[model samples]
Target: MTRHETFARPTIADKDFVLATDLDGTFLGGTEESRRKFYSWIEESRDRVGLIFVTGRDPGHVRDLTRRRGVPRPDYVVGDVGTTIAEVDDEHFLAPIAPLEAEIAAAWNDAGMRVQAALRSVPGLTLQSSGFRFRVSYDMDPDRFDDRAFDIVAELGLDALVSADRYFDVLPKGVSKGPSLLRLLTHLGVDNRKVLVAGDTLNDLSMLTMGLPAVAVGNSEPALISALEGMEHVHRAREEGVGGIAEAILHHKLLQ
Candidate 1:
């Protein structure tokens, strides 16, 4: 709590709209031309627009994504599939909010080894190399993936999240992107009404359906679209990726 509590930086309170978005497909989606335009707009409207990258990516990946990839950096990042809530310092290093993460840490309880031991031989799931602190992610080949993996995680009192029909994640119960993002915003006293949540996969569902102004980008997977069906709060955009995000910002009239 002490590391960043007293730190100072411009807050989202000053902005008219804050984008709490997922990477890979939502923000980084759209044509190269469209991405450039949207990026430029946010950079130009820094005073009015605030950005937060809420993704399954680890802090190191997030840092590299923005620092070396030329993407506009986020003011805050809810990374590691929501196990980590951090602020991007002046140097792009993540300063995790220690207090906010206490619950997630407690819930995880060093379950990684147990989880690995249990699922080591499961078919169709290849371990991802990241070695994240709070979650275990595997790349899944749906054809041979054992559905029992879900049951195993549940038995261990953890949550198993399968998204994009290709990725599997074991996370602490009740800890995911949505809850973590809400926690960060509430901690910062940012108005929920002015925040727009966006995503393109099943992993993003928890946040997208939290009753905020949200969007399922056009490029979203079928599982997510089915889940969001008839949910009036979510805008099922016609455009893909950032193009869809741009559309939602207007459809919700968020800029006004």
Candidate 2:
């Protein structure tokens, strides 16, 4: 076995622990080797390192992405920016944690009317329930939008969160990845100290800043890098995308 493999795979009681990573641009970049290594790591470290995917993609899309890429399903999935949390069981997403559904329902209804009206003004834009928020996107851009959309959201007193590229995620005030991660932590009886997070996008900011040992997967955006650089526990990955993930996994000795 390679030295890297020796270091990457460790026993659970050897202080091996869990990792919560963002999926899209971090680990799976729609590449063959990337997908191969990702699944390899997951399968190798399955017993010791609990791989949890904390992504902004909705559950359905996450399922499709995993199936298409041939990656092992995550032990836990924090989808739609923490709108819904679920566990995977052999092609099925089971054991949902719907704690926020009631709150989400109330929050959505409160902002739906105004948000819908504002979204309608943007051509090619349609709204989808993302579990925790409403997502507005255009067909041509899918994520692209002019400055006017943000302005309208501001005027309507709604929160507009941009995940990646040009996509718009509108969440209620105070809903974010940090709290969602906390909820999961509590449910699993895992302390924050035992968690390690890695991400590479705007939506990952909250969990990254939650003071866990977080690594920004790559150069990321200058603004995001700057915002997170000062955190004593945060580290930057040596490589971009999944390479960074591998680096962090090795550097931290997260798996035993």
Candidate 3:
């Protein structure tokens, strides 16, 4: 798992490529060597491969990673668990996803404060301060989670994604990583076929199911692997973290 193997170099004939990946166990889960190799490839292929971060993290959290962990700065970020999207520049300022925000926000039936008040009494649900215009997150004790809480979300026309057995995220009913990523792709005019998605958990399920080439890292949650079972153009990598991602890139012949 610690091997630092590099894949074939990008060819001149290679078409434009975009990599949309979840952080946590997917991007940051690999061995140091594998991560370094992946980062080197990204830095070297900057012109041919566009890097995007499709994460549940907020903008500030994402910024911290790039600043402290040497994570490559992303061209765009779909953060707040896909409720927010922004274009990032070299200087690290984020330009809000204009024109699309209105559409995405229409799904929020009530103010975040209102939703918070409604769910406050739900046992085992602790609000996470990392929230944005259309998303609210909470840590839940799965054993204590009550269907009534979800009922409240449904009544309010919101959707909930519970992942890793603990995170309870509430967002607009129709918004998720997949649709948000696709929206960003359309805005950038990137062909779907030229994209490769990577993830390792249930929250990442939407992006993996998008039918673009995908990589499920070896350490992916069982739920994710089960959900992705029999899917085409999806590679279940043997290596964990970026090593798995590297394997998928080679398998798909994206860099040769």
Model 1: CA > 4 A from native: 1-9
Compare candidates 1 and 3 on TM-score and give the better one.
1
Per-residue alpha-carbon lDDT of candidate 2 for residues 52-113, written as tens digits (9 for 90 to 100): 78887777777786678566677778777766667766764646766645565455556766
The C-alpha stretches of model 2 lying farther than 4 A from their native spots are 1-15, 122-157
Which ranking of candidates, highest TM-score first? 1, 3, 2
Model 3, stretches more than 4 Å misplaced? 1-15
TM-score of each: 0.95, 0.79, 0.91
Question: Per-residue lDDT of 1-256 in model 1, one digit per residue for the tens?
Answer: 7765784546787678899999989999999999999999999988889899999999888889888987998999999889999988879999999999999999999999999999998999998988899999999999999999989999999999999899999999999999999999999888999999999999999999899999999999999999999999999999999999999999999997
User: What's the lDDT for residue 125 in model 1?
Assistant: 93
Alpha-carbon lDDT, every model: 0.93, 0.69, 0.85
Q: Of the pair 1 and 2, which is ahead by lDDT?
A: 1
Model 1 sits at a Cα RMSD from the real structure of: 4.3
Measured by lDDT, the strongest candidate is 1
* Candidates in descending lDDT order: 1, 3, 2
